[model samples]
Target: MSVPTPRSPAAAPAPTSAAHRTLWRWHFYAGLFVMPFLIVLAITGTIYCFQPQIEPLLYPGLLRVTPQGEPLSPQTLLERARAAAPAGAVATTYTMRNDPRASAEFIFRLPSGNSESLYLDPYSGAVLGSLSVEDRFMKQVRLLHRALLVGKPGELLMELAGCWTLVMIATGLAMWWPRLRESGVRAFAMRPASGRRGRWKEIHLMLGASLAIGALAFVLSGLPWTAFWGKQFKAITTAANLGRPGDAGAGHTHAPVREGNHAAHGDHRRHGGTMESLPLSEVPWATGLTAVPVGTSASAGHAPIGLDRVVAIAGSRGAGAGCQVALPGTPDAVYSVSCFPSDPKAERTLHIDPHSGNIVRDIRYDDYGPVAKAVSYGTSLHMGRYFGLANQIACAAISLGLMALAITGFVMWIKRKPANALGAPSRPSSPPPMRAWIAGLAVLGAIFPLMGVTMLLVWLIDRLVDRAAGVPSRPVRQ
Candidate 1:
């Protein structure tokens, strides 16, 4: 489990520099574990980035519309979606789509525990199509990105992949480091090809070196979504009042913090309230924070104002065409108007009084604290939403570059590996370096829980294999 600290080449140990060989070994082993996942992630992430472009192409009949007239009212669309829903299922929030040709999308939680997404033509109110959210193509891709589609278990594996990717990147950088001092920073420059292996090696090094910073950005940005690490991060932000405006879990405080979804924010908003549970909707940050203000009268007998009226109210206040009006599922709940525009600066969240149709709470992007603003900006950039086509193109290019790097690295391994054994680097000539490496890994494992577990397992297996055979598992490369 020991790893070597990086060093320059000229003053380094001669033929078998343990630091160089050890780091190369780490780079090799980590790549063996991480290459397949990176390929899948890059491919899926590229697909996801172009979702605005690809979905219409894939499901044109269901997604696109004629835009012949003013589309049906929000209430009518919801009713149509409900009628179209499978028996014993209930429709929840309706996603306000940006495209005029696009159908109104409704989310339905089925009795079978799977969620179904219903798409309806806004003009005709006809059922366009229904897809199980979990089984849907993009959902499956997203699951593959987060986890290997195995739910919680898959999440751990994906997290492990992510952690080791860090290891891969670090060791890969170490391996590339000597090139900088020796060849005058030529790792970024592809040399003229000498042989097939040499050709792949140059290209691989150049690609890795060129995209290293960007790849690092991608990995760091994605860390906010890992189950354990993400939660811990969110907890810190919430506690510090650093991210997500008005997102305090202890209900409204002088400090506001926002979590990713309206549902979680709403649950936190109701931390100390006594009214019936509120329906989960994609709400803006404020509505989740704004409890029925001090004077919200109990107008129990007056049945809630219909969805159309609430939509009109939000429209008057500039809830853009892309904003959704979520009707309260509970008697006490208010209308939640939420919109997440391509520009993170345009995010808006509102809570509407159901009885009187007033905007009780309105939170805009400008209200976000410093940390929240940075996070939102970073998240938007990561999603390829910030610069329109330029953003999409850049994200796609990085993804393709990552896949290329993984492929070339794998090909290099195949070319070099001997027939009789796994072609890992030889053991370092010294053993003392390992204790420090193990300590560092322990810290990494603590931060990335699954990585810690995996490292322990791998360490134990390596130890047992070494003991049983009276030697190291792989051949000494010296």
Candidate 2:
């Protein structure tokens, strides 16, 4: 996901032409729309990147425990959690950590359609209290970062803003490209003595040029999370066999039905057949679209395997500490075990049968297709999970740098704007050729259709407004 460093504007000769002004105008509008979102994303993203350190500090009582005797069995923890849970709440997942001080987490789906994470002391099996999944600080921040605290509509807005950010970066880089001078190491020099507008302009330029790659990384890596484009990307990758293997409906297995419970087994398969119906949370990206394989049929005269046995099964398959085991919701649902390791290469997901304690489906990093593998690593890098503390620091720096860039851009605009004028760059006397617009549209549409549609609509609106005001249209350059 790394890109080559762009040449600094200080290192190249400045291009000061009407074309540059045209590019500036585009950059200005894009920034005007994108800056606010960038600021919010930066602040929220920075907070979420340090969630590992921050969550423990914020919820020590809920997450920490005293390691007295040997830890209680996983089934014991689950039983205690279920007993403490609200009436009619169903256990969905259990998170076990190898850390002695860490409490085990049991996620439950309430009858009222809400989800809650119940913490339990591993050794004492004491109920440590439950937190509604929606109310968790880091969870809310993540939702905000992706969807602005709103739902689908907000997600689309964020996606559009993200797409426009690419445009903003492109136009900004274009405006920055010709400003290179042979200043060598001094090319990045800034002058605080310059007047207010000059200072802001220099700050904006330097930050924009320096952080363009990082900004691109953030936007591109995040595109897969967008509601529209992300779904399409997932579908395309999966269809091409370059993503998670097996179809969404391809992984289900019917359990062996008891003589009197054949109808119940049929009902379960009929109702809970799809992956979407599973109460899975925080699943790995590669397995997002894949179905959770159904467990074997509930057998008569025998009890289903215990949580400790499932844990042992996952451990035998290389899913060690920090693995989340999603308990079966229906009699036909398998025990879903997933480990999102800090190293992308170590990511693993296993679906173990609840009846026979057999490994139904085992997906590991090595099973991912090339594109899926790249995205796995890219996603890890984007969230600052890979490489541990260093990754988090780098991501935090990028997030903060983007915030600074947005602020500086806004400041420059404020300083340069006249009392009654919008300070946007003037249109070029010679309009760009039709082919240029067509080519730009084609390129953008191919890569990011949503952005291309928005850009085209904006262009049309600009033309309509200009024509309504009797603005003369210049001839397109040949």
Best by TM-score: 2
What does candidate 2's lDDT look like per residue over 1-478, in tens digits?
A: 9999998875734434657666777788899899999999999999999988999999999998888989989998889988899999999988868899999998999989999999998988888888999788998999999999889988998999999998899888776665554454454666464666776777777888888999999999889878999889988987897887664244242232222332322222322343444565566677777766565677633469889899987887778877788788777777888788778888887777677776666777887878888888889999999999999999999999999999988888887776976656656667566477457757977778888788888778766766676655332111
Where is model 2 more than 4 Å wrong at Cα? 1-16, 181-185, 191-193, 251-277, 300-302, 434-441, 470-478
Clashes of each: 7, 11
Q: Indicate the residue-level lDDT of 209 in model 1.
A: 86
**In candidate 1, what are the lDDT values of residues 173-245, reduced to their tens digit?**
8778888878886557987876558899888999888888888878877776677777676666756766555
Per-candidate local distance difference test = 0.70, 0.78
Tell me which residue pairs clash in candidate 1: 65-101, 244-257, 244-258, 246-256, 247-256, 247-257, 284-349
Model 2 alpha-carbon miss at residue 386, Å: 0.4
lDDT score of residue 165 within candidate 2? 92
For residue 22, model 2's alpha carbon misses the true position, in angstroms, by 1.5
Q: What does the lDDT read for residue 211 in candidate 1?
A: 83
Assess the local accuracy of residue 360 in candidate 2 as a C-alpha lDDT between 0 and 100: 65
